[model samples]
Target: MPQTEIQILNHLPVELLSARTEDLCDILGGPTVINLGGKRPRPLVASSLLHGNEHAGFYAVQRFLQMNIGELPRSLIWFIGNVEAAKASRRRLEHQPDYNRIWTEGPRPENKMAMKLKQFIKEQRPFAAIDIHNNTGKNPHFVNVNVLEKKFLFLAHLFSEHIVYFTEPKEIFANAISEICPSVTLECGIVGDESGVDHAYQYLNAIMHLPEIYSLTETDDIHFYESVARMMVPPDTEILWEDQAPTNPNYIQLSRQIEEDNFKDVAKGSPIATFGGDGRILVMNQKSKELTDDYLSYSGNQIQLSTDSVPSMLTSDLRVIRQDCLGYLMVRRRLEI
Candidate 1:
């Protein structure tokens, strides 16, 4: 069984510097909650490794602590999630629930950890929250927010001008935290990228020292997009990446170049995939209803975009695509603020 409780620490654990992520659970014997109090009253909360395979956040945090052992600028609460999965270098085991997805109210054993974390947040009432993750595909680093408030947008702009606001896939950690304070989910590119680790470390460090984020203004160009739909492979259908063909006649064959399309505006009628036996594309809105017409159209055996739109998080990693989603369809939004 996955560890459902977290170990709390008032100071940085010096052993973390030499500890491998896999050994974290063995060290703490569970998830860990570290509070580094500083001059600032309301702490900045950062939750990392919700997906075990994404290690950039873990490394970034380690680097930050190593460099600034005794001189933190503000109160900080850090949650290290899914150390068991990190031991195996997998996103999550077959029996484990996605750590980020279990934040909603529930009594299930899997929900116990998230509930405990939520209770902690409620007691602390943090100034802001950040949940760091890494994509499985080739994509630029971006920030995702659950709300479009100025603080949220500004926080995201600090990392990248590419800001995505997603309301679906509810129960995400950032979404739950955003209800109380400004929160952003940072997608720090792929794992093992030194640049990603540096980017997150710098951003987190900057935010930790900030006296107030609500008064901040964006000096750089910022583009806002809303996630409109989630693309998923149909159940029981085989998936073939790139030029690979499927033996099953009803399988869907997505282009190997799918990841290449991330953040680019795909033109209408652009081919996204080819399916056997005249199967239609399966795209669903946040409501889980078939919204294929909103994003894609069927052309003979090929599925193409029905309208011009940008897609993010598209991945060639078949396992990730199956476990999470193919990607999300996005549309640019002009905010009055």
Candidate 2:
């Protein structure tokens, strides 16, 4: 289908931000952009709810707006995404593509909306960009950047000490907007957490008043990690393993608990899962190149990592496991300072 016209609002609707995220579809219809004037000239692009299930970004934006009812510290290009999906409280509707993945040129309505947004943002030439989200599992609030520049590092460190850098999965909001200015993605932990909402609001507020985003200093204490590989599980419908499918020869039982060990340093050959069926986990790197044979090993009935590494975002939610990814394998990188 051809792309249709998108909605862009110049002013806030009465009590729009106050509405629950799940109720947004009734007001905004679909993906919408709300551009508001601020004391500063260059706008700060804030995108949230790209995944419908995440609520931190929506509430944080609301809180920020509530505190500064009359005016904002800086110009804001607020992008509210996945409203239809939000109504259903899922990452995305079954028919719709992931909002974050359609920023590149494409034929989908979401893709066209993204292109329209990109053009508008380019015209504004914003100071910086922020795309906020919540983790489906238990994890620390961290920042993610696609680029390795000092300015990006400085911007990310302002939000949290833990930072992740990934280069693959192109056309995501932060990576795409980084072409115009510095951009960062915030993974504020857990949906509906008050602290998570506050953390995001504080970070957004701080950036609103930033005098300048120059470079990271040696004094900045930030723990940075680079994702080496992503662990992908089979679609839930395709293969039901272990817990769901015992007789089906398609899955092995994961040995370790999913949530607790996130970001824990594990030695090479640490047991990951026990053999059960003929299924194999897909392991891909930052380049989107598969490295299953290169990074995984099996000892007896156990599947193990080929090298010592840290993992993050290991989710126990079966729905997320099927929709997104199991988690990522990472290695810590020292700051050049």
Candidate 3:
């Protein structure tokens, strides 16, 4: 079967702007790239809903455009991705590849749409790029970048002072777009938080008028962390949380408040989770090495932190945990400036 190409529109589907995120599929039919002209020629490419369950970006972008109407300060190429997954409120369908990860150079059908979207932004010579998202866990608003460059750091600081620089997930949209322009991913807290929507809307409005992104100066108050490892769970291991404990040996039992550990300066020997049997939580570095014991202490059926560092994106959602990751382990680092 031939893959679906992204739908390209030169103007906003203003009539469908009010459509709920889940209902976008019926209108857009699939992934879409909308290019709207502004006072400036070079566009600012902003993408949203790469993960269908993340709706803050979608709504924020829509609201920002609606408010601007015909007074945009800069051209924009906003790609609304994963509408199919949005229809069912899933991150991605079982048979579908992650939309965000497909933007890297690849030959998959989804990558075709991503590459097409990339081509659109590349043609615009965008001054900056932003991919908006919402966490499934209790996480403060923050930004993520793939590079340690000043422009990327400053671009991220515009959204939040808490910035994470990661290189391992090199194929994600932000990472790929960084090569073309300064790019950052906005983690706008969790879904259904209006503050997140407000922040994202404010961000969109600010970026529409940005002059030169590369020279923007931010404060020394920024909190920077380098993502060094990913935390994962075995596929067959069942997750038990929120007052539920393992009745079987295949389950990993954790506190419902495990997500509260996100962004905290966790001390060594901090409890993470308890295994049902002899199994352990998996922690892997950027090279995909299994250094679980180096980062975690697992004995007596409990998993504890062996390193003093900050953890981010900790989620209790079992599907997200299995599909993507339990969370990421990060270490504090300073940019040379």
Task: Say which candidate scores most in lDDT.
Answer: 3
The local distance difference test score of each candidate is: 0.83, 0.82, 0.85
Give the C-alpha lDDT of model 1: 0.83
Per-residue lDDT of model 2, residues 1-337, tens digit only: 1223567899998667579998888888877888999999799899989999898888888888988888788889998888888998888888888888888998887788889889999999799999999886778899999998889888999999888988878879999999999999999998887889999999989999886687887534777888889888754223343455455566666633667768788888887666655666778886768888777887786779888878899887767777777788888888775
Clashing pairs in model 2, backbone N/Cα/C closer than 3 A: none
In the range 210-290, model 3's lDDT, one tens digit per residue, is 777865465588888988898998877778873686666777788888888888999988888887775558999978899
Count steric clashes of candidate 2: 0
Please give the TM-score that candidate 2 achieves against the real structure: 0.92
Residue 256, model 3: Cα distance from true site in angstroms: 2.5
Candidate 1 wrong stretches, greater than 4 Å: 216-220
What range of 10 consecutive residues in model 2 has the weakest lDDT sum? 236-245
Error of 2 at 236 (Å): 9.7
Error of model 2, residue 187, in angstroms: 0.4
Q: Which stretches of candidate 3 lie over 4 Å from their true place?
A: 1-3, 214-219, 236-238, 241-245, 299-301
